[model samples]
Target: MEDFVYFFSFQDPNVAMVVAGITLLSISAAMVGTFTFLDKKALLGDAISHAVLPGVCLAFMFAGSKNPYWIVLGAFITGAISTYAIEWISNSTKLKEDTVIAAVLSVFFGIGILLLTQLQQTGDAALSGLDHFLFGNAISIVYEDLMVYGILALLVIICILVFYKEFKLIIFNPSFAESVGLPVKRLKLLFNTLLVMAVVTGIQAIGVVLMAALLITPPAAARFWSNRLHVILMLAVLFAVLSGIAGAFISFAVPHMPTGPWVVMAISFIAFASFFFAGKKGILSKWYNQRNYQQKIHRDHILKSLFQALEKNSKTLEKDEIMEYFPGKEKLTRTYISKLEQENKIELEGEKLKLTPSGLVEAKRVVRLHRLWELYLAQYLNLAPDHVHDMAEKMEHLLTPELEAKLDASLDYPTQDPHHSKIPRDNDL
Candidate 1:
């Protein structure tokens, strides 16, 4: 508890810097990731992240020390090169983009490993934490490192804000953006630069190996909660912040625990939770809605059958006879009959069932929608009356009263369907 308080209170200057740097990095990564995710450039982000390791090694080789400025500059340069290489190779060759990205990722990362191994052989004291870049060490963030990474992250956030509309246009509708005189190619270059910067910002705190998670996971998870771009961006930022702080806290509390994997784990938990529980799009909600809808369709079928029997001058039907309509679903049909009885939509007398007044109205509406659609298909779509029943059966439970009215008006309020049977309406009651 004392550790938790001390960590969060930011009482130590170093702790404060780590927290601030991580938060800013999270925000930038999430914002860029939102567009990157929407544009489906996730694989490219992964490739650039792995490709930056060589640049980190080259920067260390040139600077003779672990200077954050040299490291970030080198990392950004190589990351950009990797991005262009993937684009160029894919466009110029018969190879697909994914194949090019894979090759670039493997070659760059392999070179980085070779360079890093050589640097380690020199036995330099400064090389002590150099390998931390592969995983990450949030605890090692000093003031100098914070300054460089924070500034890069802030720049990414600012550019995204300033060019929000252009980015959106280019991502969602590049042809339209080009038609409007937006520099689609230059904007893409600029965005790619920002993507590299975002990755670079996290390379120290989240590590190159896990940096793509910082870039991609938050926005991917946020999408399950919202469809609005701004809302999704906000949610992504919130999720990233939570995961980043949790990772930082865990690293502070546990000895020798790398922050990167913990952060990835935290974000993964949030994502899985969103997948199973988000309101409209989640698995549980979708399943519940589908079950209810299927039940409603079944209930409508039962009512329609009863009404049709009444039309034939039979006021009631034996329960077994109605169950015959659902050959393999006798149990489910019986359940619906009981539910209708409980709702006062139908009544049972001995072995026979008949619709109540409320049930009759509901049944008439369903039947009317079915016949009206059949007539609409016959008169306008040129479908034969015999060919329209199947389509109408599926659409009957989906039509709204407003749509029914529209169909009636368009069909000139026909009294009979193409089958020459009465198209029952409220007036007919």
Candidate 2:
């Protein structure tokens, strides 16, 4: 806790700058990443990250030092080349996408390693930090490197802001976008270029190997929390910024530690939390909803059975009679009856269970929906009346009033189903 407070205290301008720089970079990367993740082009980021290594080595070789501008230029060139090559190979040949990605990643990384080894043998002190780009050393980022990253991040943000609608259309339906006369092909190339640039800019601080996580995981995690594009983008940026700050602080507290892996770890933690806890789409939410839905269905079924027994025997059923109807589910039946009593849907009189007037109306509606659906299926879908009952039995709880009305109109307001059972009127008791 003290370490965290000390890290963010901003007493040291260097620490403050590093934290701010990492936050900006992470936000930009995660924003771009959300789109790539939605479009299912995450592997492309990995490919570009590895492909930029040779360019980094080449830039170092030419400049004989760690010049940010030269390195970025070199990285962008190789990154673009790798992206284009993958597209070219995928389009021109029968190779699968995974195969193409593997080929490009291995070849480019191998070449980069060779160039790095050559540079290492030359014993140049200025080139000392160049190798860190491979695995990353975020603690070593100087103010100049941060400035370069800041500019690149700004450019990425600008591109995303200006092209937001175009990107959204392309991602959801490229064919539809093209039909509307949008430049689908050029826009795809542009998106790929931006992805490459995002990867290239992170090479120094996040490293090639782990940079892919920054580009993919936050956005992927954010998706579990929102379905809307704008919401997903916002959440992705938030998660990324938090991860970046945490990772930067950890590195600051522990001298010489690489920032990339810790950032990836922090992002993974956020992702895990989102997966299990986020509302609507999260695992826990889905589980709760499923359980509630099952309980509702069970209650509806019990009410339905009580109605059926009353219809046959007149007005009420003994507790033992109801239990006998659902022998295997007797425990469930008893529990649901208790719940219904609590809800005031049913009441007990001596040894018998009776539906209140309100309960009778709801039970009647369920029965009507079931019989109406069964009739509709028999007449339209040509299913046997007996076969339709089982399906209608399950669908009764799901039918909306609008759907029931539609079914009623389609069936021409049939008074009786194929089974000769009277379909209860809306005002029926």
Candidate 3:
């Protein structure tokens, strides 16, 4: 905990500034990333990240130094060109999107590597830190580099805020937006430009290789936690910021470690957690809900068996006879019966199993729904009476009150089902 306190204490202004710069870059990338993820253009971010490498190397060669302006300009140019080429290839050829992206990524990265190798062979002192762009040296980002990143981050944030509604419309229904004269094409171009700008800004702090994670994973992870567009954007920004901070701190604490991979690792950790723990859509929650629903079905089926036994024999069913209905599911049936009894839905008197009044009403309701559905399918859907019973057996438990009402109205209040069984009346059991 002492290490944690020291990390946040701002004992060194350089550490504080590096953290701030990482936070800014992360927020910007995450905001743009959310739109890309929603639009199913996540691979485009990866393409841009790799494709910007040639531009950075060219900028260094032209400027003869590690100048921010030259690097950013070159990056923007290459990134934009890569995006246009991807679109053009996709439209003009039969190649799939993944194929186009992979092609562009490999070509551009190869060129960048070639240029870097040539520069290294020259033994130029100005190109000393050029290799750092492959991984990242977040702690080495000076104040000047931070200023450039900060300005770019600000521009990205402003653009997103101003065009929030338009972007959302384009993502969800581009054809409709175009029909409404919203300039969908121009909006896409502008969005792509912003994405490129985001990639360029992080080239130094996060690097080209792992920078795609900054622009993809946070937003992808955030999506599991929200459906609202605004909420998703906010959550994505929060996740990105957390990852950036953690990555920067780890780089600080552990000497010589690259910050980009650490940042990706942090973002992935959050994403994995969200997949398993977030409410409503999470895997664990889904499993729990499914288990509970199955338990409910089992209890209802038990009550149904008791009602059927009483209908046939005019007496309670023996526990052993009820267990026979479940065959190999004796343990599950036993637990279900115990739970039903605990809930006062069923009674166990000696060896006899009987439903309480509440259980009888519920069982009748389930049976009534099943028979009503069978009749509806047989008469209205033109399904054979023999085929309708099996279908209704599955549909009965899932019918909602509104659906039941619709079915009742459609069937015109039938008195007897296709199987010749009397349909239970509202007050009859």
Rank candidates, TM-score, best first. Answer: 1, 3, 2
Q: Give the TM-score of candidate 3.
A: 0.95
- Indicate the worst ten consecutive residues by lDDT in candidate 2: 130-139
Q: lDDT tens digits, residues 139-220, model 1? A: 8899999999999999999999999999999999999999999999999999999999999999989999999998899999
Tens digits of per-residue lDDT for model 2 on 1-429?
A: 887887778887788778777877887899889899999888888999999999999988888778899999999999999999999999999999989999999999999999999989988888767778976776777788888988888789899999999999999999999999999999998888889878877888789889999999998888998889999999999999998888888888887788888889999999999999889888999999999988888888778878887778668888898888777988888999999999899999988889988888888888889998898888889998779988997888888889888888988898898899888885765
The best candidate by TM-score is 1
Considering TM-score, which of the candidate structures 2 and 3 is the better prediction for this target? 3
Q: What is candidate 2's CA lDDT for residue 188? A: 90
Which stretches of candidate 3 lie above 4 Å from their native place? Answer: 1-3, 402-406
* Clash list (residue pairs), candidate 1: none
lDDT tens digits, residue span 57-89, model 3: 999989999998898899899999999999999
Q: Candidate 1: lDDT over CA atoms?
A: 0.94
Count of backbone clashes for each model? 0, 0, 0
RMSD of 3: 1.8
Angstrom error at residue 306, model 1:
0.9
